[model samples]
Target: MSLQGNLTQQVEAYHNWKKELIRQIGRYRLWLQDNNLFSDDISARIRHGLELLVEDELTIAFVGEYSRGKTELINALFFSEFGQRMLPSQAGRTTMCPTELFFDRNANENYLLLLPIETRIGDLSLQQLRKQPERWVKHDLDERDPEIMREVLGEVARVKAVSTAEARALGFDEGMLEHDRNNPGKVLVPAWRNAQISIRHPLFERGLRILDTPG
Candidate 1:
């Protein structure tokens, strides 16, 4: 099956699973309510399990240090020629925040949404992004409106130009730290602080999953 077909199958399977689970829960809850048997232990455990199951969705996370080719891997794996344009993967710290990718259906058309971790709608170029590390903000899912999730993703996925200052801020410096083995008085400098780019893909359906985490 094609990637889209496979994704559709997975999503359908997940929906079916979720519906069955909900039905079971409702049946159990109704039985308890009708019997007036509200055992605290049983009730609490069921509630907790339901909460966890409700939060369970297909989530694939890709993580790596700076310049570790995480973006390239995604580009090669899922996107075709047209889809490639939707996700602009490059060789730098291109992504500053966690990005989520999911498929959306509207009027019988399927489009991929790339959601970012920001609220304000502002025009940000890649070049400008590379210069200013502070321009990008961490995304808070609770504070954001669900209605605008697609729009936020659309904007965030646009490739912006990186500036020299932004590049430095992203730890793109060459030889900033050097280890001097010959000199007794030489101080050891750390090479680069750990930086991570995460991509949450909807490929995994209905079970929280993580893939490719660096130690």
Candidate 2:
């Protein structure tokens, strides 16, 4: 066979595989929707599986010095309803840790899943511990226990009514001020990494699915 013919064959094979995968995803989505599988118990795994399909998914990290309105932008884009409650945006370390928000059809409960850099679930919020990544853990992606993921994320989402002094101690307050001072110039806050996630929700068929990450 000619080399060009072989190349064409290979390309055709890849296209077939891609089409098959998409078809399978569509079927699964329809099945899930019919069965009403959009529950917390299954959302995380469904999300993980969908994320693995993209060949070159983009990871856009919202990076800027402190208080550059990165979180605000996220809020505007992904989290507007939560913003109205004056929710704890003052946690100081908005986007302190690298947060990868992706789409999962199975996530019914609106909660955060926290995974420690290591294997310790002491009483620490993932968002709060952004400045101290080394304190309570090792980063282990091979571990796929949804329960563990839930534990970690739950801790991260547990926001407290922080006092002014407490806020200063954590540097969230300082970061905001620094962001304001640096105005037009870039503000340097904790570096936050993010991923572009696209997933088919069981509820929303066709091109409709869950998209975006947690703020």
Candidate 3:
């Protein structure tokens, strides 16, 4: 559903503000060139600023202890129109890993990308891993199919039973992991280290990113 009330107004205002800023900056850049009043460094800086403004994102992060309803809050705020919870929300640790919800303006297609937990065994950080798309599992998203979407998104809450050594290799502390009741000598860890969900939603399309972090 489209944004409503004051939020709608705010988003519109923000868009207008960005448009005006970009126009003014572009004008300034042209004026500087027309009058030969600025150095090359100044011109480059102004161009960079304009680019940054166009690509700026508004990110909202939900952080709290487990079972504090972060995922539920996200559903209520952004995914309620789906007629069901878009992200896993339950009485326990539903969001197993850090998940980022955003609209991929470049792709303009819905999809989910999950980075394996074992990626942590290497020295690469999450930001670095994001550049290596081959390391992530990709799933196409279809909002038209709620059941399939739910099932696909359910991957975010998945856990795998691993030996203590494997858990340590993934940089998970024993205290932070839950023992798998079904397996005596294994502990359960998040199957995925991180998740990126790209969807076409009004707010998300406007560069609004929502981050759900596990406790």
User: Which candidate wins on TM-score?
Assistant: 3
Residue pairs with backbone overlap in model 3 = none
Candidate 3: 10-residue stretch with minimal lDDT: 1-10
Candidate 2 Cα errors over 4 Å, as ranges: 1-54, 82-88, 91-93, 106-110, 117-215
lDDT of 3 by residue, 1-215 (tens): 44445565677788899999999888888898799898989978988898899888878799999999999988877777789988899998889999999999999999999999988888999989999999999999999998899899999999999999989888889888899999999999999999999999888898888899997
Question: If ranked by lDDT, best first, what sequence of candidates would result?
Answer: 3, 1, 2
TM-score of each: 0.41, 0.31, 0.91
lDDT of 3 at 110: 97
Model 1 residue runs over 4 Å out of place are 30-37, 63-84, 91-97, 102-215
Model-by-model lDDT, in order? 0.46, 0.41, 0.90
Ten residues in sequence with the least summed lDDT for candidate 2: 194-203
lDDT of 3 at 102: 94
Steric clash count of candidate 3: 0
Decide which is better by lDDT, 2 or 3. 3
lDDT of 2 by residue, 102-175 (tens): 44344422333334322222455555564564443332221235344333333322333333444454455544
Backbone atom clashes (below 3 Å) for every candidate: 12, 19, 0
lDDT for predicted candidate 2 compared with the true structure: 0.41
